[model samples]
Target: MSERLTLPIGPQHPLLKEPIHFRFTLDGETIVDADIRMGYNHRGIEKAAEERTYIQDLYMIERICGICSHTHATNFVQAVEKILNVEVPPRAKFLRTVVGELERIHSHLLWLGVAGHEIGFDTLFMVSWRDREIVMDLLEIITGNRVNYGMNTFGGVRKDMNQEEIDETLKGIKILEERTLYYEKVAREESTFIARVSGVGYLPKDIAIAYCAVGPTARGSGVNYDVRRDFPYAAYDQIPFQVITSERGDVLGRTLVRVGEIFESVKIIKYALKNLPEGPITARVPRKVPQGEATSRYEAPRGECIHYVRANGSEKPDRVKVRAPTMANLMSIRHCLLNQQVADIPIIIAAIDPCLSCTDRLILLKQAGEKEGEILTWEELRRRSIAKKPL
Candidate 1:
């Protein structure tokens, strides 16, 4: 009989599973069971929002995830605006959508490059990221930043689009479209790429739906629901696009969904630029928000990012809760890792395109009745929960 052993992947600079600890029970490289733990990088962003005013929280929420910063800011602004009953300017809505799609393109390309590096395909990684710089440059031209565009605000956006910027954005999208076509060909025809991802980490449709997985993770598993399509935020109601999905439900399927989303984003950006309206970008907003609670959702690059805000009759918010896409996808991700060989584990986890920074973390305590304990990081504490040997 094969001996069962535990394998740990940690930030000890070993397996490089940053911000999350994974312990797998393996029988000769065949994973028999797995344990996923959180609480490594929790910053209490949600609790912090309660202390800040509505205006201050906008930027704070934007910092939730660097890759999907705009999505976070937009959704937070939308939730607050709903409480204030403010009608965002038509042009502002369109502009916010443009930046959102641009961020999506940049994020998906980043994921593709990272996925390539995970499987030892550095050439594809280099080429994909090289093309991603075009989108980054365009974002910088419009919003003056690469990572965190800082465009979203309560009631509207901070920056206004001009003719030159619109023309430049269209040109950049064209280049990305052409490059996407080539990458699509490679993904379809490349022998080694197909072999590695195909059938690896198969997440069935039932598991995806049951776990409430959102974004590409849910879509890739044949679940046909997209927040942009169903919920319709920003200018999504005005703009037209299709949700990409696959029945394969494997790592390859999610990759295809993200690639297809890039093309769709290109289309949305072109449509928004062509139909760009002229008007004031920022709307007049009141200092004090009314007492109420609301939820805002956005189709972020990873998946569905939701923000819940509860405002009292004051400048500061009473409560603000955020649920990131990676948190939603983790359950299904664990299921995907099961029954698979250890060698394929890295790519399989990377398949969800996990943003552990967004997953954040929480406190874990171990004690007897009527006792509570503080949380600890790996560096702070070791040899924990040591049971007292039977006396």
Candidate 2:
């Protein structure tokens, strides 16, 4: 009989910067059964949205996930817009698509860097992130902010891209396109990078569909469902681009899909810039929201970000729920982790691009044998760490 060895793989793991724990039941070095535990960074943002007005909830939604901040805000505003029957102008739609594509560029690069770091490829991480700054610089030029570009309002965007800024942005997109091609070559042709990812964490299309995987996770598994393509919003209907997918359904497959997506985003951005209509950036929206319920979905960096809002004819929202892509994608972890070696856990998890902060409340739970011991709040964890260390 094989000895059953239990391993706790996070809450604090070397590969993941986020707080998530995976309890792995291993037969020697190969995992047999895996259980995932999250909620390590939940801020109760969904429940808190009830207290804020519709206008204020825009900012609150943006804070849900730092990496996908604009996407979240865009999704939230779109939901409210649907409820109020507000139609954004053509120029605003174009600008929104431009901003969304730029956000995609930064986010894909960030994921690439983290994936590299997970596999001990610091050179790739550094190079990818340095290239990512070009997009960030472009975003800063247009929106006046790098990470959280608060561009979205209920009716349209707050900022406009003038001719000079448009010219500069086009130049930036060209540079990014060149860099992305180089990164793609490294990911595809380089043996070390390929070996680290290829055939690792194979998420087949059938299982991926069953688990309701989204974004690159689904695309990697030969599922070509993108919110931009399926349900076109903003200027996405007018934009020309392909939804990149792969048949391999492994870590390497996800990498290829993301790299392919970077190229497609460049195409979409260029199209939007060339055909961009001249008009007002935003439209007039009412201060008070009508009593209604609406759902909005967007192709976020990770996957499809769905926002559902309920209003009671008040300035404040009655209920708001954000279904981040990671929430759906995280469901497939068990299927991917089984029968894989212990060392591959981090890279595999990173491939899903799990964002704990957006999905769950961060809580620390202690276990005594098979029974639960005590639930430690994030506050208690901080206090314990401070008590242990004299800092």
Candidate 3:
């Protein structure tokens, strides 16, 4: 009988730039069981939100994940708007949708680049990221910031798109749509991409539903539950776009779904921009909000980003809890990683589009001979590093 072996995949794996450790119990190359340890980058943003004013919390929430910054801010502001019973203007809602879709494009393209790099497709990675700059440029032209758009406010948005900027964005989207089609074809027909992705790290439909996976992770498994469709926020109801889904439930399925979504986002953005309403972008919201609690959900780039906020009739909130999409999808890792070879781990994990900063805080834990030991702080790790006398 072959003996079982234990392997620690990461706290710092090449596949994941973020810090997450996966302990795998393997019989040969097949994983028999897995344990995931996160919280390596926990910044206590939720608890810190309670200490900051509503407006201040917007900036804090945006920092939750750099890729999904706009969605986080939008979700946070939507919660506050609901708590105050304030109705954002139609124009603001349209603008918010535009900005949110732009963020999605950037994030998905970034993921595609990362996934390509994981599979040794440096050319694809470079091309995907190069095309992604179009969306980033459009976002910058519209909101004046590349990553943190700073578009959302308590009641509405801070900026509006004039005719010239709108025209420029439309031109950019046209270019993006063509490039998206090209990438979609590559994802489908490229043998190398297919071999690495198809039928790899599958999260079956039943398991995905049971695990409550959100966004593309759920949709890729043929679950058509989009927050924008079911809940309709930020001019989604007024715009026309389809929720892309795939029944394959594999890494390839997730990749295709995200690729398809780029076009859907373009469709939504073009529609919203063409039919954008004219009005004051910013609405007057009181600095101190009334005592109330509200929850807001948005379809972020990775999946659903939910924000729960409780206002205590003060400038600062009483409590803020964020259920990021990655947090929900992490539950499915054990199921996906089991039976898959070690080499597939990076691509599989990347398929879920994890935001380690949102889900983990880096505190290194030491374990000795199957017995867990003390957790090391960053300062401790720094101090423990050996210094060379001379080189």
Candidate with the greatest lDDT versus the true structure: 2
Clashes of each: 0, 7, 8
Listed per candidate, the RMSD to the true structure in angstroms reads 6.9, 4.4, 4.6
Better candidate by TM-score, 1 or 2: 2
- Model 2 lDDT tens row, 1-391: 8999999877888867787888999999999999988777777787778888877889878887878888999999999999989999999999999999999999999999999998999998999999999999999999999978999988999988889999999999999999998999998899999988999998989999999999999999999899999999999999888999999999999999999999999999999999999989888988779999999999998999898999999878999988899999989978888899988988999998888777873333454566756679999888988896564
Q: What is residue 307's positional error in candidate 2, in angstroms?
A: 0.6
lDDT of each: 0.88, 0.90, 0.89
TM-score, per-candidate, Cα-based: 0.91, 0.92, 0.92
Q: In model 1, what are the clashing residue pairs, if there are any?
A: none
lDDT for 95 in candidate 1 is 97
lDDT of 1 by residue, 45-78 (tens): 8877888888788887788778888988998999
Worst 10-residue lDDT window for candidate 1 reads: 382-391
